[model samples]
Target: MLPISYSSLNNSRVNRDGSSRYRRFIPEYFRRIFHYPQMDIEYTFWIMFYLCFNPSRVYKITYWHKQTKNQWARDDPAFVAICVFFMAIASMSYAIAFHYLSFFHIIKTIFWAVCVDFISLGLVVATVGWWVTNKFLRVSAHNHSVDQNVEWLYAFDIHCNSFFPLFIILYVIQFFLLPILLSSSFLSTFLSNSLYFIAFVYYYYITFLGYNALPFLQHTVAFLYPIILIFTFYVLGVVLNINFTISIMRFYFGQ
Candidate 1:
C-alpha cells in the first residue's frame, strides 16, 4: 500500500478519471467571470507584468500553482477578463491615434481586435497546442499509475501568457514608435520586421516554457521549431523591404 499525498487525494475528487472536471471548466469559468470580487486582479496584473519582463518567472508560478492547486490550468477567469480589457483599450488607442473617428469604425476595430484577433485566434492556437502535446508529447501511461494529459484550458492559458508580451510589443510599444517605423526607409523596414521577429520568437519561447514546465511532457523543444520559420519570414520581409507594421495597419484600418 502507498501513501496518497493530500494533493493527489484532492485531485482525485475533482478529476476522477483525469478529464471529467475539465469538461465543466468553461461554464464554471464564465460563471466566475462576472463575479468581480473573486477575481484576483492584482495577481493577474503581476502575472501580466512578469510575462513581459521575465516570462520564465511567470511559468514558474504555474509550476507552483500545480503543486498547491492540483491542477495545471488556472480556474480563475481574472486573467482572461484582464486580457480582453487590455486588448480593447489598445485597439481603441490605435483607432484614436490613427484618426479613426467614426463610431462604427471604432466599434469595428474593437470587435476585430478583441473578438477575432484575441479570442478566435487564441481558440485555434490553443486547440492545436492542446492536441499536439496530448497526442505526441505526453509520457507513456504505463510509466505512472495515473495517466497525465495536458489540459485544454492550460493550453489556452499558455496562449494567453504568450499573447500578452506580443500585445505589448506590437500594440503598445509599436504604437509609440510608429512615426519612425512607418517612415519610408530601409532602417524603418528593418526595425519593423525585427520587432515582429522578436515578438513572435518570444511568443513561441514562452509557449515552450509553458509546456516544458509540465512534469509529464517530453521533447518540448518542438514548440520552439516555429522560430525557424519565423526567422525565414523575417529575412524575406527584410529582403523585400516590407514594413510589417504598416501592412498590419493597412489590413486593420485600411491606412
Candidate 2:
C-alpha cells in the first residue's frame, strides 16, 4: 500500500493504463522525504532532484539522509534523464546562439559532449568507489564467504546517490551558465570558476555525510578525500579538452 501522500494523489482513482490518475511530482516527492527520509531510495532520489533545482538546501538534505540506517545501491534513471535533457537543451542553445555550426555539426557536438561528460564522470565515480572499498571498507565477519567484488559495487552505489546533486549542478553550470557568460571572456571565466568551486565545496560536505552514514566505512581524517577525487576529475577534463582542441585544429586548419 502506498503512503497517504502517494495514494491520495489522484483521489484514489486508478487510470486506464493501471497507473495513478494524478501525477504528484514535487509535493509527493517532498512528502516521502519528510516522512521516510533515510530508508527510501525513492526519497533519496527525490531529494537529489530537489537539490538540483534548489542547490542551497544541499546541506540539509545530506544531513537528513545520513540519519537513515538503510543502504541503497540502485541508480536513479529519472535523474539521469533530466540531466541528459538539460544537456540537449544546452547544446541546442549553443547551436542557435552561435549560428556558425550546421545542424549536422551541432548534432555531432552534442553527442560527443554528452558522451564524454557522462563517461568521464562515471570514471571518477568508479575510481572513487574502488579506492574507498579497498582502503576503508572492512569485510563483514558474517559474510566472509562473499566474493570481494560486491564491495566495490556497493561503494559505487553509495557514491552515485551521494554525488548526484553535484553532478547535476556541474552540468547546470556548463550548460546554463556557460552560454550566458560566453560573450565576456574575463567575467565568464571568473564567474563560472567561482560557481564551480562553490558547488564542489558544497558537494564535498554532502559526500562527507555519506561517508559517515555507511556502516562499513567511517573515518574522520578521510573526509577530505573527495577533494582529491575532484581534482583528479579536473585533470582528466583538462587533458580531454587539450586533445579535443588538437583534433579540431587538425581537422579544420590542417595543422
TM-scores, all candidates, are 0.88, 0.51
lDDT of 2 at 14: 51
Q: Cα-based RMSD of the predictions, in order?
A: 8.8, 10.8
The runs of at least 3 residues in candidate 2 whose Cα sits more than 4 Å from the true structure, single-residue gaps closed, are 1-45, 50-71, 139-164, 167-170, 173-180, 183-189, 220-223, 226-255
* Worst-scoring 10-residue span by lDDT in model 2: 241-250
lDDT of 2 by residue, 1-255 (tens): 855776566644556334432334343433333443333456545666655565445444433443462223332334444455566766556555456368786786577546655445655765775686556564454555532322343444444444556555554445465444443354544554445555676666655654554445446346567677766654554444333222332453243
Residue 233 CA displacement from its true place in model 1, Å? 1.0
Off by over 4 Å in 1: 1-26
Clashes of 1: 0
Q: Model 1 scores what on Cα lDDT?
A: 0.92
Question: How far off is residue 154 in model 2, in Å?
Answer: 4.6
Q: After superposition, how far is residue 90 of candidate 2 from its true place, in Å?
A: 2.6
Please name the candidate that would achieve the greatest TM-score relative to the true structure.
1
